[model samples]
Target chain A: MLLDKFQSMAGVRAELEAIGIVPFGAVTEKITSATEGVVNGHQVILAGTNNYLGMSFDTRCIASAQAAAETWGTGTTGSRMANGTFAEHIALEQELAQFYGVDQAIVFTTGYAATQGMCATLAGPGDVILLDADSHASIYAGAQLSGAEIIRFKHSDTNDLEKRLRRLGDRTGNTLIVVEGIYSMLGDVAPLKEIAELKRRYGGYLLVDEAHSMGVLGEHGRGAAEAAGVEDDVDFIAGTFSKSLGATGGFCVSRHALLEAIRFSVRSYIFTASATPGVIASVRTALKIITAEPQRRERLWENAQLLYTGLKQLGLAVGPSVSPVVAVTIEDRVEALQSWQKLLEAGVYVNLVVPPASPSEKSMLRCSVSAAHSPEQIDHIIAAFAAVNAARPVGIPVA
Target chain B: MPNYNIYVDYIYTVLRTIKQDVEFTENTDLVTELGLSSLQVMELIEHIEDHFDISISLNILPDINTVGDLARKLQELNG
Candidate 1:
């Protein structure tokens, strides 16, 4: 009975095995570049990875990481509260705050921890949290942990959100309204402009998780909040180094001075070991690159446009907008699974997202474009999808 | 405090909007009997919160199972 929950998972694994496909944990034999990798013996274009700026293989980042490894050794080996608070860690925190134009920033071991820690510590019992229904798992975990009265408004529906906020009435001041800059699954942006207006009318602190939008949106790549000209209205900004910075770490930055006091209260920040010197170094280098080169962001958007048009022209149901994350919805799970395998065999790798993981009931072949992907590579990715569509049964719908 | 029967009747009204055919009572299991998805459950909670004008802590969700259980919780909160 203790392991009964795993029975269903085991059954699902067995079903996939019978089909001779390992969709979830397909191993990458080697990464050739930010855009290409050898996956399951197939040389495939890496479309699923969230390496938006493609800093993963940047020579400057690599060199910086190497230098840091040489100077500070490999890892910090302890939590920041204990012995892991290295100079580079503090520097990264300072640089992150400066980048976001905030007074303070607290770095965490991972993006999940950063968002979750903030959500958990910012509000507690007797307080209310109004979050988007399609918020990331970290937000949900943190909200539940906070023991607050959690209310989920329909995803990106300002009317629904306003209705809930109105219901809160005098308790609006005690509410923390949480939303994401760009939703990961569908790549649709939050209506921050409208949400900020609502917050002004009602009263609540706003937190935006810019995990998918940090390096993908805005003039200076500050994310959706900046693009919408609502940076001042935003109370806290949580982001991850894993996506755009091309490293593994998370941070929460805020103009509010209370963030400093809240820093010591976050258990995740205190319990988890600090990021390695190498990760910190690479992220620092990546941040500088992001600031200096606006061309990367432009090229990324261009690639996204190309892919979006290509997929749309092929009659595939793509995401709501032309975003770095382009998801093709497939209502049939079997077709989605088979199409994913077919794409991999054709030298294109993407993420196969199903229910629960996907925001909706539909299965999605999620592809994330990086600035490093050449135009030719984008065409090839489109070609692979076209090929799969052509091979589908006559009665079945094309994904 | 609101009468527990009033809470139950109001819950039934909300549940019918989600599923018209299913018969619900105070003792009926909200999850197993009605087969309400997580999203549906949240929708039900939102409706209840709107009607009552009271914020319900999610920490109490695990302890709530039947219509009666929810009604009792609502009554306690209203009290």
Candidate 2:
């Protein structure tokens, strides 16, 4: 019975193999640039990776990582609560707090941990968590682990959320409302202004996960809350250094004084080894770069618009807006799989989302634009989609 | 507290709106018999919550099996 799940998984894998493609995990042989890579031996434009600012290959970040590795050795080898709390770890936390203009911040091993830890630790038994149905897996995992009563509101629907809040009534005071700045699958922005208004009328703490939106939205790139001008109303912000920061770590910044106390209670922070000295160094440098460079965000948006418009002009079904994440919806799974493979062959790489992973029954080819993507690269990516569409088997409806 | 039978009848009525073709009864398994996906199950919970003016924690889902079980849980919560 324990192995039955694996058997079911094997059946799924067999079906995928029969189709000659398993889009879930394709190996990248080499990363030639921030926007290009050799994937499965085919040279392709990297349109799926969430390297928004493309700080991964920055000379300053690389130099800092190298210097940190040389000075502090490699890994921290212990959890932050134990022997892992280095001076640099504390400094990075302080820097993140400053970046968000918050009084407290805590760092985690990965973005998943940061979001999950906050979700799990922020509320416990007898408390309630109201989250978007389309929230990331980390949020779900954390909510389930928290021993809290969990409720899912319809995705980005302020009316649905308000109705739930009304139903909560007195219990609304103990509820934690969780939403993402930019949804990962379809790249839709949350209606934070309306949600903040609801929170003001109906009492609840708000936590915005800005993993994808950090350094990609707002004048200073704080996230959707800042862009929406409800920063004061937002209780907490959870984000990742892995996206725009181009390093491997996550953080939670809050103006609440309880955040420092929460640091000791989060199992994810206390149980896992701290980030490597090299990663911390690179992330610190990347944070500075994000604050200094507004051009990167502009370039990223330009590339996003170019890809989104080009795809739309090709008569493809794209997301509602021109977010850095452009998802092409295809109703038929077989056609989606075939199109994904064709795009790869045409020297473009994008994510293939289907089934439960997708928000709905439709499969999507999710493309994420990066600041490092040149206009030519964006055009080529769009061209690959066009070619794939043109070559679709006759009688298959255009997505 | 409301009569337990009233809860059962109301649940069957709600279930029909979601799956009009399915034959329903108190003993019909909500998951296996109706073949409700996770999303559908959540929808069912939301609808029931709205109609009854109650908050149903997803944590209680594991213990609920048949239509009757859900009604019983509703009674317990409201009681």
Best by TM-score: 2
- Backbone clashes for every candidate come to 0, 0
Tens digit per residue, CA lDDT, model 1, A1-399: 799989989999999989888889999999989999999888999999999999999999999999999999999999999999999988988998899888899989899999999999999988998999899999999998898888888899998899889878899999999999999998999999999999999999999999999989999999999999999999999999999999999999999999999999998999988999999999999999999999999999999999999998989999888999999999888888899999999999999998778876679999999999999999999999999988876522644
Task: Find the candidate with the highest DockQ and give its number.
Answer: 2
lDDT of 1 by residue, B1-79 (tens): 5678888989999999999988887899988899887777877887887787665666678989999999998888776
Question: Candidate 1: which stretches are off by over 4 Å?
Answer: A394-399, B1-23, B46-57, B75-79
TM-score of each: 0.94, 0.96
Q: How accurate is candidate 1 locally (lDDT)?
A: 0.92
In CAPRI terms, where does candidate 1 land? Answer: acceptable
DockQ of each: 0.39, 0.60
Model 1 Cα interface RMS deviation (Å): 2.8
